[model samples]
Target: MLVTGGTGGLGGAVTAAFIEAGWRTVVPVRKKTSAESRSGAVGRGPGSNRDPKATPAEGDAVYVSADLTDPASVDAAVAVAAGEPAAPLRAVVNLVGGYAASGLVHETPIEDFERMLSLNLRPTYLVTHAALPHLLAAGGAVVCVSSRAAVAPFAGAAGYVTAKAAVVAFANAVAVEYRQRGVRCNTVLPSVIDTPANREAQPDADHSRWVAPADIAKVIHFLCGDESAPTTGATIPVYGRA
Candidate 1:
């Protein structure tokens, strides 16, 4: 399993869930230092040590340095993840995305709109494009993350809403293109994920209704597993209580 953004709050939970389920997880990080630091974050559960230089001597999870937005870098990262012939790459969870709240369409800068698209969509397209051949050969699964705002939009975040909606559309396209080849693609839409960063961002919000990272991770893991073999092009909403 190759989990992009596996070092982040939600991605870390996803990586840890896969590892706990006995999958050899490979995470792509942009920097060697970030990879080294994330080694401890994803290998274990949330709130684990985050030492900038801590390196696990041996573990089921390994981090490879690669810029996900670049095709060459994504290809190299995929090669490293699919290194062993015995254990080919079987799953790709694209969690390499971001959220930005900007003004209305007229008030937002063109650069901000482009950045939103680049940040939320480019890495997913690049990584999935580069990994399709291997996934086709292995009959694997592809999972992407989209936001609830995509379907149920609010004011003042036009760029984020549009970008997230594009993600879902891209995943649906992949599902249609590869369903016969045994490559399943699906998107998960989350609503206000309950992470430390989010809590800090919205200090007074009712976090009890927010979804947990671990919960979403479990959903992603299920989508990648054999139980969901018949499920493809499904946009599953993982809004916990919210």
Candidate 2:
């Protein structure tokens, strides 16, 4: 399994669940995005990216350091995931995402707009392209992490809504292109995931109403597993009331 942004709350739960299920996992991360890494919120080292912290105590796990926005780093991470001597990557879950520039498009800087696109969209494009050869070899699955924001705009995040909207459509496009080849593609659209960013971004909101990482991870595990074989080109929303 290959999970991008795999050290954060949702990513960590997905990684842990897959490990429990006996699937070796490779998590890619970009540690330098900020001083307080999202991975730290889940009790993992930052800047180590996906360096395989201290060797997994149980099922296999490795960290591949890569900045998805950089084509070279993205390619390197892809190489690391597929080059594994094991059965090769059977699934890829893109969990890398961010919300930037909470303003009208005209007010947001062009750079912030591009950054959001890189964070939410480009990783899906680059990593999926990189992993295709191996996933095709394994005849496996491709899953993109999207948001309910794609369908309904939040009060102040026009950029986030736009980026996720693209992801929703892009995942479907990928599914359409690959479904005939025995490969499956899908998107997990969660609403108000209880992450540090969401908490900070909406301080006054009732966080208890949001979906938890474990809850979303369960859906991801199901999508990657065999039972979801008949599924493709679908967006499964796992949003809580928020």
Candidate 3:
């Protein structure tokens, strides 16, 4: 399994869920933080970590330094994930994205819009493109994390809305292209995720309705498992009453 952005708040929960489920998950992180100094598997690339001192915790996933935006780096991380013959790369969860509310469309700069597109879509495309071969080798699944805003658009975030909608479209396209090839792809549309950053950003808002990271993680875990074998090209909304 390859989980991009497995170092962030929601990503940590996703990684933990996969580990708890006994999958030898592979994580592509920008930098190996102190918490991940003991990364198990190491891959070779421009920004990849090859230090031998790294090791996996009891049931932790393999952490590889990678720049998801870079094709070579993404390929390196996928290689590490598919390295183990016993546990072939069977799943890929693309959670690498950001949300920014600069202003209305007229108030946002072209650079800001392009940056949102690059940040949200580029990594997902690169990682999935690099891992397709391995996923095709054996039956596998791909889960992309979009947002409720993609469907229920809000004010002041045109770039974010467009990028997330693009993600859903991309996932659906992958699903259609690979349906007969034993590769399933789906998208999870989460409402405002309950994370520390979101809480801090909307300190006065009602946090109770926000979806928990663990809750979403469980949904993602289920999507990649055998139970969802019949599911594909689906956009499952994970809005927690928000």
How many clashing residue pairs appear in each of the predictions shown? 0, 1, 1
Highest lDDT scorer: 3
lDDT of 3 by residue, 135-201 (tens): 9998899999999989999999999999999999999999999999999999999998999999998
The true-versus-predicted C-alpha distance at residue 192 of model 3, in Å, is 0.9
Model 2, range 107-151, lDDT digits (tens) per residue? 878777777887899989998988888888888999999988898
Ten residues in a row with the worst lDDT in model 3? 44-53
Query: Tell me, what's the RMSD of every candidate?
Result: 5.0, 5.1, 4.3
Colliding residue pairs in candidate 2: 50-63
State each model's CA lDDT, in order. Answer: 0.86, 0.79, 0.88
Model 2 score (lDDT): 0.79
The CA lDDT at 159 in model 1 is 86
Q: In model 3, what is the error at residue 110, expressed in angstroms? A: 0.8
Model 2 steric clash total: 1
Name the regions of candidate 2 deviating beyond 4 angstroms: 31-60, 200-203
Instruction: List clashing residue pairs in candidate 1.
Output: none
